[model samples]
Target: MAKWGMVIDLDKCTGCTACTTSCGMENNRLPGENWQDVLFYQEGEFPSGTLKWFPRPCMHCENASCVEVCPTRATYKDADGFVLIDWNKCIGCKYCMIACPYGVRFYTDEKAPIQPDVKQVFKGDGQRSWNPPWRAPDSRDDWKHGVGIQPNGVVSKCTFCYHRVSKAPKGTPDLNPANPALREFTPACVVTCAPTARYFGDLSNPNSEVSKMIANQRGVRLRDHTGNKPQVYYLTGGAGGAVPTDRRGKKA
Candidate 1:
């Protein structure tokens, strides 16, 4: 089995929300529930300050605290390095949300972050939170894997576009969007990255691009100190922003 992972080159990212937009379109998320979010902030002070952005996705931690804290066993880490939620088993207690240091989890039962609630505007068929005019193919609606719009009361997060990644040919080393053959199987955020900052591949394979990038570029995981062991890694390389250093602050 391959341990899939992602490498993001911070130097190459342009702070555009293409990744965020594509993620919402692919996943049928509500207006404010962005599964892939790009965090923008200013560094330094006055004229010397620079605006920088960090693309935040679920870490899909190897040792996921969310999985450990779920009272209903809704959260789980797959052998292939995916941290997924089984929506069927989820009870919306938000324990997993509390457990995640990255603040990537979302419980959509509250008022919409945007003005009028879009979920109410476009009501879901039954248990689903809301029904969009269109949606991922029927094949993508697997609650067991948390692939579709979450039902009422369940939490949701990024799943690395599991509907696509799960179908890649066996033993595929990487899901490179640059490769025409693999583009369809790649995550929407990665495929739409205008700057090509995102890279995904089998981390366990020494020859995989993700593995080589980690080894050569000195990739670092976010909040590694928290011991979530995020499968996602970032290459800051001094040109882009450095890894977030404020450990005392909560995610905005």
Candidate 2:
């Protein structure tokens, strides 16, 4: 069995937010939604200051706190290791959102951030800005939008492109021998990154690329103390936008 996971090398990340943009467009998220957002903030003070950034996606934890708290079993883990939500079973209770430590989940009907620059919202397009690929006028009975069915009034989060991954034939080869392309098996954010900072593959196989990276680079998962056993790992070694200390004077 293959357990899908990801590794993000912070040393190669540029904090350009390409992953965020590609994730939104590929997932057809609302104007305010950011499924793969990057955390960028200033740290330290005075001359020692530096800018640090972390790209955040659904941790897809092994324990999956969201699944445990859901009354309807809307949040569950698949055999492949991704924490998924079934929109049909979701009762809009938001239990999963509250339980999630990473704060990555979102409700579908919340007020989308206004984009006044777009002239008018949707104009005359359709019901939602982007109709889900699985949607048919006659059938709307699926439990969740993990496959792009993001129904209104449900909590939703990243699915690691399960729809795409599910389509690939069994025993998919390693994707990291070279830079992965925007293929059906690759997540949009992974392929679109200019810096090649993100990697995705099966974690169960010790020889898999993601596993190798985790072992070789000393990758770490955020808040592992929670013991959710997040599959996503990050390798940190970059200067993190460090600048030289003052050699001359100060004040402008």
Candidate 3:
């Protein structure tokens, strides 16, 4: 079975925030909520100063503390080794939020954002043209189905766009679609990255490019000492002076 993972090459990342914006738009996340975020860190001094741009998405830990602590089993790891939240099962306890060391999870206190004038047209029999329904407006019935703004009183976070990956076009010989074990690849952020800074593939396949990159680059996972064993890895140092300290430096 393929152990799906991500490799972020710091060398290629410009901290452009395209990935962040794309993730938001694709997921229809709340205006103030972000499934993926970029953090800027400052280091060194005066003349020799340096900046670091750290883009953080869910770490999808092998030993996910968030999953372990969720009283409702709302958060759990998927078969492909990605941590996911079952919004239907989530009870807004925010235990996952507290348990995560990376501060990635979020609780939805109110209904997801609504744009009144926006219209959606469904294709097929009894197809209708109408505005996308809201959870509050629909009495929270919408929360039980499809991707949309999460209902009120639920905890939500990045699922690495599991829905999109599940629907992506199947494989070729090099991509090998016939193998059931080869399925369950692709994530939204990886597909959205403009500079291709984020790479995703089976890390367990030694012949895979991600595996080769891991062998070649000095990759590091955030808070590795905590024993989360995150599937995401970051390649250190690049032309951008070691990462940006702020949005201003990020644009620099």
Candidate 4:
């Protein structure tokens, strides 16, 4: 079995947010609930100030705190390196939210992150929070893997596009968007990256691009001190898009 992972080259990232847009559309996310987000920060002073952006996604940690704290076992990590949420098992306790150091988890039922709630605009028929008109016809409600539109009370976050990635050809080393055949199985965020900053592949394979990048390019994980051991890695060119010392003041 392949241990899936991602490597992002911050030097190449232009902070275009195309990844964010594609992820929201692909997953039928509500406004302001972005699975892939570009976080901006400023460094230095006055005239010498430098503005940088960090693309934030679920760390998919090997030692995931979310999985550890879930009282209902709603959150789990698989052998293939995916950290997923089982919406059916979830009880809306938000323990996973509090446990996540990345703050990538979301509970849309509480308050609208943006004005003029879209859920109110397009109400769902039953348990679904909203019925998006433009929802993908092929989209499946595999709540076990955290795919599809979330029901009223469950928490949601990035699943490394499990609905699509799970369908990739067996033994495929990398899911490069540039490859026409693999495009269909690639994650929406990786496919839409304008600068080709994102890379996805099996971490266990020493030959995989993701693994080689981490070895050669000096890739780093966010908040690694927490011992979450995030699968996602970043390659900042030591300039723009540098990781924040503290994304939020408080530690998780």
Residue-pair clashes per candidate, as listed?
0, 6, 5, 0
For candidate 1, give the lDDT of residue 193.
94
User: Whose lDDT is greatest here?
Assistant: 4
lDDT of 4 by residue, 18-113 (tens): 999999999998889998999887776679878888999998998999999999999999777899999899999999999999999999587888
Please give the lDDT score for candidate 2: 0.74
> Could you tell me every candidate's TM-score relative to the true structure?
0.95, 0.83, 0.74, 0.95
Candidate 2 lDDT over 61-100, as tens digits, reads: 9998999999988889988787988876888899888889
Ranking by lDDT: 4, 1, 2, 3
Candidate lDDT scores, in order, read: 0.89, 0.74, 0.66, 0.90
**Poorest lDDT segment (10 consecutive residues) of candidate 4:** 243-252
Residue range 1-252, candidate 3, lDDT tens digits: 446677888878878877778777666555546788776676667898677677888888999999999897878887666688776787788888898978887776643345432322311122112233332233322333224566556777777666645444432111222335433345556766777788776667787677787788877887887898888888877665243322344454
Query: Model 4's lDDT to the true fold?
Result: 0.90
RMSD of 4: 2.2
Any runs in candidate 3 off by more than 4 Å, and if so which?
A: 110-147, 168-185, 238-252
**Candidate 2: misplaced stretches above 4 Å?**
117-120, 123-145, 177-182, 241-252
